[model samples]
Target: MSDFFIDIIDDDGADQGQEAEVVSGSSSTWKIAIIDDEESIHQVTRLALSSMVILGRPIEFLSAYSAKEGFELLSSDDEIAVVLLDVVMENPEAGLQLARRIRQELGNHNTQIILRTGQPGYAPEEVVITEYEINDYKTKSELTRTKLFSTIYTSLRTYQHLVAMEQSKLGLQKIIDSSASLFQERSIREFSEGALLQINALFNIHSEGIFCISSGPLAGDRDMIVAPLEAEQHRIVAATDIFKSYFGKAIDDIDDITTKQTLHRTLASKEHQFTNKYICLFLNTPSQWEGAIFIKGDIDEERLDYELLSVFAMNVSLGLENTKFFTQLTQMAYYDMLTQFYTRHGVIDRCLNTAVKNGEIFSVCILDIDYFHEVTESLGFEYGNKVLVSFANRIQSILPADSVFARLHSDVFAVVVFDDKPLDMEFIAKQCAEAIHVDGDKLRFGVSVGVSQFLPEDNLSGEELLRQAEIALKLAKEVRRGGGQAFTPSLATESRGRIQLLGELREALASHELVMYLQPKVSLIEEGTVVGFEALVRWPHKEKGMIPPNDFVPVAERSGLYYELDMYVVEACCKILSEHSELTRIAFNLSANSLNRPELVDDLENLLARYGVTHDAIVMEITENSMAKGGIVIDTLERLQSKGWLIHLDDFGTGYSSLSYLLDMPLNAIKIDRSFLLQLHDSDNAAVLLKGIISICKDLDKKVIVEGVETDSQKAFAMDAGADVAQGYLFYKPMKLEEAVDLMKKQS
Candidate 1:
């Protein structure tokens, strides 16, 4: 055998004079444990492996004299790579039991075990190796210096492979987790910093780096032109370690020429460049900005997984693209594209945030350009856009620096001023009144303003405050085109009441709460005989008592409910004519909106047919304005007159009375308004005007019905002026169907 083993065998008793020395642990050494009942074996094994090294790491020898001592030593030191176990200690199966316990109890599966026994017959090699989880089985005589070196070297190499695989698994897991965290960043700079940090962690290196971006075309550009890297065009968005101070500076400002050149080359080639000294990872996004990450560190080129790095780079690119898309969406949402002002939603958010910060009173002003539609209709929309932009600029110049200005909608802008005083609306109007130069044309426009205050005690939300301003704006437009109005609590109250009444009115129509009342028209020449009756609609509210026509008629018109109301009146009149033949005819008024309906004639005829009433029994009365509406109203009137229905112009002298309507319209009669009769007692000019109107109607072959003749002097004057009909309280007031029937019975 080798001299090393001859010495170990011959000098068996020599170790009795000395103890085996214990070696301290080290990161660059593989731990080995020697366990046996004989101190000579421990000394011999330690001497044989003292100068040996495996996988570039020296051995750390831990000596134990018995199985119990070996178990204690191995349990305390988990880094032990290989154990030389002795079979016969205090008991025959002591080494066998300790081997099983090391694999099971201590759970040190990675530590390789080699069983050696001086009495091989006591523990058979096959049984001990199979039953005990031992890596190798050998007799003490067979374990010479050569075999011992080969066995320990092979076991230590195996342990090295296992540790490397475990570290690779953990590093890959960390990469996946870091990728997820990088995607959560919303800004380019934030994402870059996270990427740099994650890469450093992946390699376990504390390196310096800079993330630089160049302004140019994006990933999917057709031309694929990359802008020249000027000092202003290239920006270092993120930096780490020694390069942290270089963040937001130009890439050219980097003192290292190698780093700057590598970044430029990587971006130009659109590919990653890996080297022993540094790594340049190319990055491209959908935002048309190309970039690169320059990391200054030595990475193992042969060991680096390029495929895994590419996957991480793809995730970085996607994260950058997502951030760019989100930024673009935010810009579109918060700013007006044309005027570069805050949009309505952006302004409201600003107002809410400001209110929370200041907790002080402020005013919101809404300015609407008057006749803006006319401007768009006369000029092209392009020109109109220029006017709008110029107008916004003018208003913005006059406002305070801290004020929030927004474009609410077309031709409407809003302003939120952080002050107790309201905006000087008159001065704003005057400023906008100046002519705007658009395409070499001077265009003058007026603005109407509405203001609403936000009081902390009122506890109004931003949306509610804006709503109140809009309400005042509507009133300003109605009160005067170029004036301003402040919001009042009564206005909102009145608006709410109107809305409630409208809802109730709709229900009233549906449930038959509206009743038809008739006021008799008498013929003075026939000694106060009841000639015909005028149909009037009255609402007997369940809560508010009787609602007059003046109260609800305008509401119906404004709400587009006048058509249904008019048809209801017509149907009621037709029913009356069908019920009592003595009531020869009934006259009911039609609003201008109702008269303009295409189905008005058909609806009226259908109602008459349903009630079995003759066409001549229904008289369609419209105001002068309704007749003067000219196209559909006049055509509908002529159609009804042709069908044997008389069309009377009611409230004749009240609105826009045109002589053309009196002469050219299909009118069978004219009812003079009540104002003329009321004016007769005040002036003789009223008498002359009334008589002249009656004379003109007579000459035009039309009958005259004098309405609202309440006094004796009015009745006498109507008869003397040759009026065909006189409707007044002097004859009969408006009453229900039962009362009208009783009055007609007395007349009969």
Candidate 2:
């Protein structure tokens, strides 16, 4: 074993003890290896270079005696910057062979090699330097202290440059990889966070920093760069390292005064600022937004290439612009502008991503605002918008923080709850029921809600959940408005049945399976003489037999099929009038939806002309609710009345039975609903209400037809009440065309 000792040689050739600096404690150090068989060579070299510091780092020496040991030592520490090898150690060509192994076997092209030899005759310096990848070659006798120091200095400098170049290459590659990822981010905050991490990796620094932005047009204006700003204008969008907790805070809220000042200067100047202790990079976006990243730590100027940083900054700016654009497009697609709630598409996406995809249980509730059109029609649409906004705010206030609320249609909104517990639908209903104050007026409206649950066991998609909820909503509106219902299997079955029946009804209309049945309207003052007949629609299915009107009428009304059905009824009545002249003034009911059609009068005129039926022979019966609609319905009635058709208000006491409707509508007669008659025998209020309705119709000079008179008492009450006509089972059941024609002949 070779013992190591540090002996400094003087000019007199006496050895002197020299103490080496304590460089082992330094965080930054340059590692060098001395591979030689002679212990004296190691001692002298260590004595000479022990006090040397290059590039602000102390030198760390590693010793290996034999060529094999040197190879092992170099293989273990690739960071060894410089290697000094002695020729003729263990063998004449051992140093040469080890050099080849270091470069070829270990693939270490970085460590600088210096060769020293005592036998210049054995190995020529030029040949050895060229073939062995040696940086410097010297004879031992020629290597004075001055030459040794100069050679070591040059080799260390060369090694430093090579390492820096390699680091630069890696950093640039990192920037390229990071730019690709940053460009893919569609969120500004996410992109900023990723950019901060990449910046840290690019410079190989562990520093605290924040990414901040000032938004709006003024932020991007070059002229406004130096203007005084509000403290809250600069928002910290992302943070890294110790500044992670500072995210979303304003720049002024940062505790570090120096960091805040530097960031403010960088943003105000719209330029990059680099100091000995920190770095601030200003980023410009295509939008009216400016941003800055403040890194609080010393950066090596050698690694901080201005050109590379410019390229990186340009990429970050493009990424920010792309993120902003995509974010805006996303908001427009997923959020409603007026209410700032999620749109229908947004709600479905949330359900899929946050619940259904994860197999989590959730529930969906849909709300339809009843009588919404009246608000828009009575007030202006702008005022109606305020009401909708108020209603949305109320709903949002009552929902859980995690719930997703959205506007699905003009008057329909939806809520998606993530919890597995049953939704408190009554609470939602009560919240929505509160009156909305719009423009100093308390506008009251009813909200009908339908709810459905999503269970992993059910295996339903988000759209299917919404469909089920809508089915329940339709039932709520039909069974009773201003209430809520949860989805049941029976509702789905009924919906499917209605859908099937609607298809069949369309086919029936085309095939003429639907026919008009008439019941005689007898005059009470004329000793029960038949004056006219009320036409009713009846469907006789080829296989299922006669289907009652009640079974399909509501279905048609809900499905928007009532218009076609009403037109069919009108044409049938025209056809009957043309065929039998004795059957005159046949009255058929028109639905509220049918009355709102702009072409109703024109279509009726065409049908009458086609059948050669006069206008006086046909009567149009609309419900009291149709009169209450008051806009298109009233206009349509007036147009028909002006064209000489008799208009009768049917089901008067059934819906919206306001006396104002009797005065406002242009009606030739009013038919009391059978519901009033059913109560009249048992309740005195029913009799008094019926009497009052008939007296009002008489005072208005409008004829009164009493419907559903089944027994003698009902018939006597109709005559005593001075009703102009009575139509019931007692007079004649709704009969076929032949029976009706025979009855008309008998009455004549």
User: Which is the leading candidate under TM-score?
Assistant: 2
TM-scores for all predictions: 0.63, 0.70
Clashes of 2: 0
Q: Write the per-residue lDDT of candidate 2 for residues 60-140, one digit (tens) a residue.
A: 999999999999999888899998998779888888889889888998878998888888676645765776677988877
lDDT of 1 by residue, 1-748 (tens): 0111011211232223222121111126789999898999989988877865554457789899888898899888988999998988989888998998898899877788998899767655576677667888888888776677767867775665555445445544543443443222224555567777666545433357888775331111111123334433667767877886666566666788898889878987999999867888888877556788887865556546567667877777876676555444554666677887777876776555558456777888899999899788887798889988999888888878878788989999998888887767777777777787877888888889888988788877788888888888888887767878889999798777878989999999999889999999999789689989999999999999999999898778878899988888888888888989778889999888887889988888889889999977888888877865677777888888888888898998889987788878888999999999999999999999999999999999999999998999999999999999999888888999888888888888
**What lDDT does the true structure give each of the candidates?**
0.77, 0.79
Clashing pairs in 2: none
Maximum-lDDT candidate: 2
lDDT for model 1, on a 0 to 1 scale? 0.77
CA deviation > 4 Å runs, candidate 1: 1-282, 286-310, 323-341, 369-394, 397-402, 425-447, 524-527, 624-645, 683-685
Q: How many clashes in each candidate?
A: 1, 0
